[model samples]
Target: MKLAVIGLGMASKPHLAALKLLADQIEVVGLYSRSESRRAAMAAETGWPAFDSLQAVANSDAQVVIVITPPNARAELVQTLGAAGKAILMEKPVERDLARAKALVETCEGFGVPLGIVLQHRYRAGAEALADLMASGRAGKVLMARVSLPWWRDQGYYDTPGRGTLDMDGGGVLITQAIHVLDLMLSLAGPVAEVMALTGKTPLHQMETEDFAAAGLRFENGAVGSVVATTAAYPGGAETLELECTHVALKLEAGALTLHWRNGQTETVGEVTGTGGGGDPMDFPCDWHRDLITDFAARVQAGQAPRVSGRDALRVHRLIDAIERSARTRAIAQVEAEA
Candidate 1:
């Protein structure tokens, strides 16, 4: 299979690394960015062909296109590539908000293209193991879910133009940093019926969007949970999702999954790994990205939906919308699954 990657920004680093690992499985022929210098630098760095323009890449022989542009730069790219019948795997948040995000998905679907979002956290080994456990019924019914994403980012991190802004990154911690764990939480114990949240920016960082959030949720499955997502913590740590189920209690911190059974037996799957929660955002390994990219390539080859399809990713977007609404109205917002 032939693939291409667009937008030569910092986010492309992990994807490029993943592509390097999967080089034997597929050929990455074109890399594109608006800036000629960026294209030259990346081409020189990775030894991959750089496209003259996005249109050139779309018009090329690439079967899968990875879109790694910022949140504000997705709609037009998706439109162009979709019209060219390219399968797109994009980075998270879809767009700054839900409406544009939906349009991107619908555009690709309407054009009969496979669309996948890069919410790589769910691809962590421990997360996949837990998903399997729940599917096998050994995890039983979930009664409660508790999540915390205590992450730290220096002001310099936010100092990057549009780093923590509504127009560029789409809100702050909830949409950017914690969307990974929130999506995984919804995947495990969600379809949250309602959400009551408080979102605000702390004095620690000068940013337009919320850097901290505390929310209470009621899942449609009768499970209740609380969430604390913030970049205000001095030193960021791994995000955690602890589920208390009917038969077993599960704790998934970073990449490790642990189970506490009713009969006093405890078991663990996978091991704790760096989550890039600290001052340096790109501190973690590229293995998760590797697995996700490999999976997407195989699925695209098979004419099947990628694991994290655009429609499936909209689930978290909807929940984030509800959270923002609840924070504004000071009311418990109902999560409209279709909204």
Candidate 2:
């Protein structure tokens, strides 16, 4: 399979690395970025050709296209690819708004094309192991869970004019960072049925969106959860995404999954890292992108849906949308409408 990557940002780097990792089965032939310098930089990193326009990029020999574009432009780009008859792997928060997400989903489904969203956390070894444990009933009833992402983003990070603006980024830390943890939370604790949330913005940052978001959640499986995500923390430690169940507490700390169980079992665990990016950020204990791309390629080759399907992405998207509404109304919001 040949792949093409659109957008050259911090996130796209991992995708490029993953493509290299999957070289045995796939090759990334070309890259597309609006920024000429970014295209040059990526071309230097990976010896792939870079193009300036989406049309030229789409017309390349790649059978698969991975879009890591901004939220606002994703739907249109996906639609264009859909019309062009190209398979796509898109980056998440499918859109900054729910309506656009729905339209994009409809467009893909209408075209009967294979469409996927990059919720790569689900592909991590620790996540897979814990998910197996949950399915095996080792986690018991899963009474409650909490997800906290208190990472720091200096004002300079959002100093750019468009940073953190609702129209661009969609929302703040909850939408950007916590959404990954939220997907994991949903997987572990089951789907959230309802939520009541409060969002806040401090003068510590000069951005149009909220810097903090707190939500109270009731899961469909009778589990309760609380989420507090913020980009306002100072002197941040590791970018932490932690979860606790009735019988197990799991966290990804310093790039390892730390599991603490009721019977006094506490240890860091993960699966064998496969042949993938071999250094620094790539060599980190967990290479989410490599595993995800490999798995997706395998599934696509076998004519099966990806483990993380587009519909699953839609569910998580709905939950995020509900959280936003609950925060805006300062009232409980149901994740699903009444049957």
Candidate 3:
């Protein structure tokens, strides 16, 4: 499979490395980035052809296009690729604006293009085992779900342009850093019916969006949930998701899972380390990205929907939107029905 990448930001590096792992099956044909210098640097470093414009990349023979641009800058480029009948794989938080995200999903659907989001947590071994256990009905119904992502980001991290802005990277913590845990929570507990949240910036960071967030959630399955996310936690801590079912309590810390059953039995499953809680934003390993990208390539070859399709990612976006709205309105926000 021939592929093209459309951003040379931090995400592009891991993605390129992961694509290399699948070199026997896939080849990166071209790259495009708005920053000429960055593109030149990437080209010099990787020996990959760098296109001058999005149209040039779109016009290439690449069958799949990977978009690692910021959430605010994704729609137009994605729409262009979709119109050209190319499969698109986009980074998380499909769009900063919920309405625009919905429009992007619709655009892909209108053109019959397959759109996938890089929610790599879903491809983790522990998460996969947990999801399997939940689906097998052996774990019983989930009673309570909770997620905590107490990560740290120094002020300098946000000092960069468009770091935590509402117009660029989208909402902080909840949308940017914690959305992976939030997506994992949704996967384990099912859809959230309503949410009440509060958001605020910490003294540590001077960005426009919140560095801290807490929320109360009510799921459609009668499961109660809670979320606490903050970049203010000193030195950061592990990102954890816990699900209490009638018979078993499943806890996932980073990418590892531990199950405590009602019968006094405990078991650990899967292997993968947590991303850096040491205040480095780019500290994650690219193994999960490799798995996700490989899966996308196989799914594309089979003409099937990817594991985390655009429609699938829209749910997480809606949840984030609801949390932000609830924070602003100081009232419980009902999650909009899926489009």
* lDDT of predicted model 3: 0.89
Best by lDDT: 1
lDDT per model vs. reference? 0.91, 0.75, 0.89
Looking at model 3, the pairs that clash are none
Angstrom error at residue 210, model 2: 1.2
Q: Which ten residues in a row have the lowest lDDT in candidate 1?
A: 330-339
lDDT of 1 by residue, 1-339 (tens): 999999888788889998898888989998999899999999999999899988998899999999999999888899899999999999998889888788888898899999999999888889999999998988789999999999999999899999988899988999998999999998888699999999998899999999999999999988899999999998889899999999999999999999999889999998898887998888888999999989999999898888999999999999999999999999999998674
How does each model score on TM-score? 0.98, 0.89, 0.97
Models sorted by lDDT, best on top: 1, 3, 2
The CA lDDT at 271 in model 2 is 43
- Pick the winner on lDDT between candidates 1 and 2: 1
lDDT of 2 by residue, 1-339 (tens): 788889888667678777777778898888888899989888987888888788886677777788898888787678778777777888877778777777787798787767788887777777777778779987677777777766667787687666788888888777776777788778777788999998989888888888888888888988788888777776544444566667777776433578788789887766434211111222333268888777776776677776776667777778888989998888899997422
lDDT of 2 at 245: 69
CA shift of 114, model 3, Å: 0.5
Q: After best superposition, candidate 3 residue 78: deviation in angstroms?
A: 1.3
Q: What is the C-alpha RMSD of each candidate to the true structure, in Å?
A: 0.9, 3.8, 1.1
What is the overall TM-score of model 1 with all chains considered together? 0.98
